[model samples]
Every structure is written in C-alpha cells, then in structure tokens.
Target: MSESLLHRCPVVPVVVIHDAAHALPLGEALLAGGITVAEITLRTAAGIGAIEALATALPELHVGAGSVLVAEHVDQVVDAGARFVVSPGLSVAVLARAQARGVAALPGVATSSELMTAVGLGVTEVKFFPAGLLGGPAAIRALAAPFTSMTFMPSGGVSADNMADYLAIPAVPAVSGSWMVDPGLLAEGRWDEVTARSAAAIRAARGSGAFQRVV
Candidate 1:
C-alpha cells in the first residue's frame, strides 16, 4: 500500500448510512470538516449502495468499507468501489480476499495472538476494537511494545474526549469512531453537526502532533 489508512487522516469517521442518498452530502460534510477519509460500515443494508454512491459522487474522498465479516462481503465491497476494508475481528479469509482484490485491509485485533496472526498475514496496521473496554490506551501500549513495526487504530469507545490519549501513543497514528458521523446524526440529516464533530476530532488529534506524515 502506498498510503497507510491511519496516516490518510487523523480521524476516520465510521459511518452507518441508512439511506444511500445520504452518501454524497455526508462525504461533503466530512470533507468540509477537514476529513478526507471515512469508513462506511455494512451493518445496514444500505452500506454497499452508499459506498457506490459516495465513490461516484466524491472521487476525492478515500472511502472504505467496514463491518466486513466474510470473504464474499469483501468481494461485494470491492465491487462497490471501496478503497479499503475494515473488520471488527481478524479473519484470515476476509484478509486474504482483500489482498487478492489488491486493497488495504485494516483487520481488528483484540489480543496478542490475533496481532501476531495478522503480522504473519503481512498486515502492518490493525484496528484495536472495543478499545476502551479492552484496557484502552494502556492495553495498546503494552500490546504494541512487542511489535515495534506495527501500528494500531483504536476503534470502539474512541472519542474526542480520549482521542488525544490514543494519539499520545507513538504506535497510534490515527483513531476510528462514529461520534462525528453517528447514525443518529445521519438519520436526522444533520450535516452541520457532522462537520462540527469531525472538525473537533481533527483538531484534537492534530493537537498531539502525531500526524507528521500519512504514509
């Protein structure tokens, strides 16, 4: 991968768009807030269509697909124009499919075994899901010490309130969460609120000075 996902943007908005029509405006809102990349999860039926819509409407945004659980889902997402793939757990089949499709895969790793497995699979970066519940920054600190070359993106429970904490760790170049693009905000068509939250998240991450280079 020429550009690492974590470095593309300090905060990668994890969005669950209920309506495919909302994709364009949502992308615009994120871009307006200084965000250039985002992950549209497949938790809802509209996920794939949303990815396709955003891909066609906003070519500049580095859009990715999240909640990818199966290898078939990987194919579906790639066909929909997802530049990358994100999963909530480490799945060899899913990662392998992403590699075959020739896109970056940000698989989740909640334990050392999973991290090691990911390394063996040629993955350099991973998503630390349920981060706050899994000991948060402290856990990442301890887990990251063993893998000097690996980096992490803390997911669940990550917010502006604790984004700085995650960025403080040298291993974490960026963090992922839905606070900015929460489903509720999207459902309400609150584009302005989305932009505001996105801006605030970026400002918080930048304050840590950890966004030196994206790649």
Candidate 2:
C-alpha cells in the first residue's frame, strides 16, 4: 500500500486548485503526463470539494489531502473520500484520526526531534518540510542516517532543477512539489501546459539517473 502511494511516481505533484471544476481535467492532464498520483492541498475552501471530485471522478489517481492539521480536518478530508492525508507538521490528533479512518498519513518534520517523534509513533514515512531551507538533500541524508529504515518525501522548495539532487539519496523514494501544477496554471485553465509540465517533470525524474527502487 505504501509502495502504491509513494512508488508509482517518483514525483508527486502538490497541487492547489482554485476551483473544483478543474479537478477532473487536471487529474487527466497529470495522468496523461505519466503521473498517476497527486496531493490536492486543503489550503483553500475548494480543497475538500476538489478531493471529493477527484476521488469520485478519477479513482485511478491517488488523490490526497494536504495541509490537514487537526482531527476534525482529518475527518473532513477522509469523509470527502481522500485516499490519503498530508500535514505540514506532525500531529498525533490528526494521525490518530487518519489511522482510525484507514487512510495513509504522511506527516511533516523539520528537525531530528520531530523525526524521532514520528519514529516513536510508528511512522516509517514522512515529509521533510522546508527541505531546501533545512539543507535539502544533504540535510535529509544526514537526518535519515540514524533512523536507517525510514523513507522521506521532500517538499517545500523542491523543484525540477533539484529533483535529481533529492532522488540521489536512497532514502527519498519520491519528492513532492507544485512546479508542474502551479495554482496559476489551474486558475487559467491551462490544461495543455499542465500536461506538458507533468510530462516534462516525469521525464526529468526518470532521466535524473538517481532513481533506485526505494522499497
């Protein structure tokens, strides 16, 4: 199950949709570009609706909810039919609710302390937030060495140019970013551009020559 969530695509687009109307077409664009997974962040009111729409219309896509912080938020997203949930920081309340709901959870961590907290809670996968500011790939390499069995999803400041750098590390099975599905493009209804960028991102990740079977 984790493999299906994090291994199907090396790069998971962290998308923010302004309108629920664009969900299906956006998922199609990303799918056409060789990407079968995406995290539709709950940064706006449209977020839950988008997740429901995507989960219903494109069950083939691994639709996830992001920026989820509390138990209520978890309940909301899970009830909306989100297959997974992502948070900006580790929250036991959210994690517990997600677990109760049977949805995969990827909580964010910015330091070794938080990482340890995740490990203590039986988490094997997490998001290294603000990765670039925390030293990007280098930081994750150092921080992950101690855990030895964890896989990190590097987000924030992750981009096309630096994807290879993150993928170079065996611990990083996948990296999440919004470069391909920028909110502006969705706002403009630029479906073709979205598809092209998604395709280009996939090619870049595959050709980075840093990919390894993480699981």
Candidate 3:
C-alpha cells in the first residue's frame, strides 16, 4: 500500500451519488476547493459509473471506492478505475482481492483483535469506522498506543466541528465524511456549496497539521 494515499488530502469527501451524471461536476467542485481525494461509495447502483466517470475524466483526483463489503465489489470498483478500496469493516477476502488487483485497501478496524488481523495481513493503514461512536479521537489514540507503526483514517460521525480534534491525533492522517458532499446538496446541484464546504474542510485540516504527514 502507498503510504501517501491518506496524506493526499486532509478531508476525503465520502460521496454517494444517486445519479451518475453528478459525478464529474462533483469532482470538479472538489478540485476547486483544493481537496484532491474522494471516496465514492458503493451504496448506490450508480457508484460504479460514478467511479469510472471521475477516474476517466478527472485523473487528478485520487478517487477511491467506499462501503466495499465483498471481494467482488473490490473487483468491480478496481475495474471501474478505483485507485483504492475502503470497507466499513475488515474482511480477509476483500483485502486479498484488492491485493491481487494491485490496488490499495483500507479495511476498517474498531477493535484491537480486528486491527491485529489487519496487521497479520500486512496492512499498514486502517479506517476507524463510526469514529464518533467508537469514542472518536480518544479511541484512535488508545488503539495507536500498542500499534505504533499503524496509521488511521477516521470516518462516520466525523464533521468540521470535530474534524480538527481527530487530526490532532498523531495516528490519524485524515478523516472521511459526507458533510462537504451532502446528499441534499447533490440532489439540488449545489456545486458551489460543495466547493465552499470542501474549502472549509481543507482549512480545518491545515489548521490541525500535527498529523498531516504520513506515518
């Protein structure tokens, strides 16, 4: 896995596009805000098309797939041009498939046992899913205590209000959430709003620069 994958952007927009056509404009908006990474989720049927559109049209954006639950999903996104794969939980099959496909994989780990399993698989990075409910930055700090070599990206319940807090942790290089790319904003075609929120997120990340570097 590329160590710099999570360091490309401080806030990776976790996007869910209901319409594939919205993908390009959204990617452009993210770029306008100085964010260089996006995680287009597979929660919707248009996910594959969205990933392909962004990957083909906006090669500058480090586009990745989120909410990947199976090995087949990994293959689908990779073929669709995803550079990375993110799951809500650890899955040996998903990790193996992603490795076989030669793409970076970030499997979520909310427990020490799960993290140990990831380490066993030679994973150097992980996503701390449902970060807020899992004790937020405090949880990551505790987890990082034993796994000194591992780095993390916190997602779920993460927002601008507490994003800086998460970035303060030495183990977290970035955080992922949907605030900048809200479903309502996408449905309304509010590209400017997306850009504004995305810019704000970038500023927040910059302010909390302690963990901005790759671990």
Candidate 4:
C-alpha cells in the first residue's frame, strides 16, 4: 500500500464515468484543484476503459478503482493500472484477492464488527461508508475509541459543509466523495465547474485545521 497516495489528497474524487473520453479532462480538473487522487467506479459500463484512459493520460495522478465488489473486479482494476482499490463493503474473498495482488484495498466498514473484520484482515485504513446515514462523525469517534490504531476514509454524504467535521476526527485519515466532482457535470463535459468545485472541497478539507490535530 502506498500510504503517500492515500494521504496526498484529503478528498478523493469518487467518480462514475459513463464516457471514457471524459476521464482525462475530469482527472486534469481534479489535479488542477490540488487533488491528486481519483476513484473511477465500475458502476458504469465504460468504467474499465475510463480507468485505463485516466491511468494512461494522467500519470501524475493517483487513480484508483471503486465499487469493486468481487475478486474479478480487483483483477480488472489492477490490470487497468489502478494504484489502489476500494470496495463498498468488505468480503473475505475481496480482501484475500487484493492482498494476493499486492494492491492497497480500502474496504467499506460501517459498524464495529465490520471494523474488527477489516482489522483481522490486517487493514489499518478503512472506508466508513454511508457516513452520514451511519451516524457520521459521532459514529466514527465512538468506533475509534476502542480501535485507536485504525483510521478511516469516510465516504457517502461527505460535502464541503461537513468535510471539516469528518476530518476533525482523530480516526479519519482522509475522505472520499462525489459532491465535489459531480458525475452529471463530468458527463456534461463541464470541466470548469468540476475544477472549481474540486478546489473548494480541497480548500475546505485542508483548511479545517483537523490534519494538524490528528492524534
């Protein structure tokens, strides 16, 4: 796992690209805004192509594959040049596959049991998914109480308004979200809007003063 890639950007753009052509422009916009990571989800048909495109076009950007639900998905992303892999939920098969492949896998965990399972798999950093619905910062804080060594990347419901709150938690190392880089905007080829939104979100996350308070 490349810890530097995970920490380089406070907010990772969780993107679902329907067009492979839009990948490069969207990636450039994100990088321009001081964000170096992009997670191209396989939720769309063109996902694999988009991931390959971004990896080729934006070598400086750290590209990852998201919504990886199966073992084959992990192989697909690795072959597509994904630097990391993210799953919506943790599964023994998924973790084992990722570990065997030697890629950084961030499995989603929303409960204490899930967190424990991820820890058992030797994952130190995890994704606290559906964060807003799962009690958000309060839930994370409570979960971190017993597992202080574990950190999280809170996704789902993360927005500029509350990004600081999530980052303020000592258990959170970073966050992943789609609010900054809207799929509609990217689909519509609105690169400028995406760039601006990415910049705003990055500023909000970094300006929160939370990174300095990590304990």
TM of each candidate vs. truth: 0.97, 0.95, 0.97, 0.94
Which pairs of residues collide in candidate 2? none
lDDT tens readout by residue for model 2, 28-135: 999999888789898888999999998999888888999998889988998898988999999999888988999999999999999899989988989899898989
Tens digits of per-residue lDDT, candidate 3, 6-79, equal: 77777899998999999999999999998899999999999999999999999999999999999999999999
TM-score: model 4 vs. ground truth: 0.94
Scored against the true structure, residue 204 in model 3 reaches a CA lDDT of 81
Winner by TM-score between candidate 4 and candidate 2: 2
Per-residue lDDT tens digits for candidate 1, residues 135-187, read 99999999999998899999999988899999999999999988999888988
Report every candidate's CA lDDT. Answer: 0.91, 0.87, 0.91, 0.84
Q: Report how far off residue 183 is in candidate 3 (Å).
A: 0.4
Better of 2 and 3 by lDDT: 3
Candidate 1 shows a clash count of 0
RMSD per candidate (Å) reads 1.2, 1.6, 1.4, 1.9
Shift of residue 51 alpha carbon in model 3, Å: 0.4
At residue 83, give the lDDT of candidate 1: 94
